[model samples]
Target: MKWVRSKICGITRIEDGLCAAHMGADAIGLVFYEKSPRYVGLDQARSIVQAMPAFVSIVGLFVNAQAAQIKQTFDYVGLDLIQYHGDETASFCEALALPYIRALRMQPDVDIAQVAKTYVNARGILLDSYVPGLPGGTGEVFNWSLIPSLDKPLILAGGLSSTNIAQAVAQVQPWAVDVSGGVEQAKGIKSAEKITDFMQALRANR
Candidate 1:
């Protein structure tokens, strides 16, 4: 069995970021959206990134941000990847000239395959649960059966935790899995124990 890559998102503190990296997480996300409680300031984000060991990817999460904002953050933090969690067009994403992952909120009517095709240049397509008037961190689980097999890598997100991750991996077999609120001690604060358990469960499944 292949190892299921893991990214611990919504990191707001340097301690949490280092904890995730120490626990073997492939990536740690820094939220740049002001509305999100997990949002990190540019200075904080840079500090967290600087604290990380080599080989740990630093991902910047944005929600409906302008190009200038993204560019400003990128120039400062030097994120390994960008995760767009808004209505960004493929051209808009491509214009940044940086590797990015498009987040697709799964509503019943959503055509994921078509969305994936439209963002063909994306490094991966992140499938997250949809909630009315919310961008992400909803902690709601969607129907995994809605996912279709495609050549592009699938990153399963939304409502993932140590309790359900094994079942989720067994069902979806995604290229990667992203978790935020699920392993959190509070909004934006991660628990090292939770992260360790989550990784243990994933390894057990493999």
Candidate 2:
């Protein structure tokens, strides 16, 4: 099957959320960690999720947050999925009993297939660049060639732009693709033009 998926993370405003949905995003990620520049408060996250059109999934992103904190955010925003970017254990992730995606920091010499197997119950695997001091949205791409035969759904991320997404799709053929800094006017701010361009490019590839 043809792989076609897109994610817009770090939404700070309702309009940005709307743009992502209107532009045909499969998922919209909301950051709950205060340390993240793109973090949105409970109220802001709720409003944004509510404003989003139907069929667009709401994904809550956390970086090394506790279960209590994750539950609190979920209760407030009612996210459909969880994206764990930090060193969250399998027990911690399964405790939520909700669908989730685990982010893998792609590094040279790492056994990519073996790493994915550890999160066997995950809804999908998110492959991102291993940038020091950056949780995600670093606008960096790992070598696409390093994907070592995936069995579960794979969501390709990091440094993807409209210009190169087709190349990414052609090569990795992931179940989905995610972009944040690549489609932003600035950190936490999305660009309508960029969103449209990205979607158009995505369609062109298909």
Candidate 3:
């Protein structure tokens, strides 16, 4: 059976983090970018990290952050992986020395295969919806038809929810699906019921 892994992102509360873990989420994202409403402070991130159970990966998300800031957050939060959500060059991402995923915002004329090849060292290529000013967490779905066959693993994101995840998985058959606002009751706040429903939907499709 091909199981589609799920990651519940934008976790700001300890309870939400634990809920995601308990609900069989493969990973939980912690936002480090201060400008986003879903951003988590170092102390808050630490608390969430400490409270989470083992085996669930802690992914730290950044948006063109300085290396020093990333290192400081890594040391304090003990992130297992990094997700770069800005216009960071492959070299800059590699310099961090941590397993990372590169987010490619899918625009109308973007060349995904070429970008994926460019970031060939990335653990996976995360496809997200391209919004004019926002980096990520846009809560808007892109054209699933635009995705191309690639050499690296694929993690499909952007506007994924309980209602549409199954269809998205059946269409894309990605290694994983990432959700943030889709499972949230409000910005930075997750809804346990939504998470459970989303997982159930994904499992049913698989």
Query: Which candidate leads the pack in lDDT?
Result: 3
lDDT (CA) for every model shown?
Answer: 0.92, 0.88, 0.92
Error of 1 at 176 (Å): 0.2
> In model 3, where do residues sit more than 4 Å from their true spots?
none
**Model 3 TM-score?**
0.98
Cα lDDT of model 3 by residue, 1-206, tens digit: 59888899999999999998988999999999889999999998999999999899999999999988988888889999899999889888887787899999998787888988888579999999999989999999999998999788899999999999989999999999999999999999999999999988988988
Per residue, candidate 2 scores C-alpha lDDT tens digits across 1-206 of 48498888889999998998988888999998798889999999999998988899999999999888888788889899999998887787887777889998897778978877877689999999998888787788889887878778999999998989989999999899988888889888999999899988998887
Clashing pairs in 1: none
Q: Taking the tens digit of each residue's C-alpha lDDT, what string does model 1 give over 4-25?
A: 9999999998889888898889
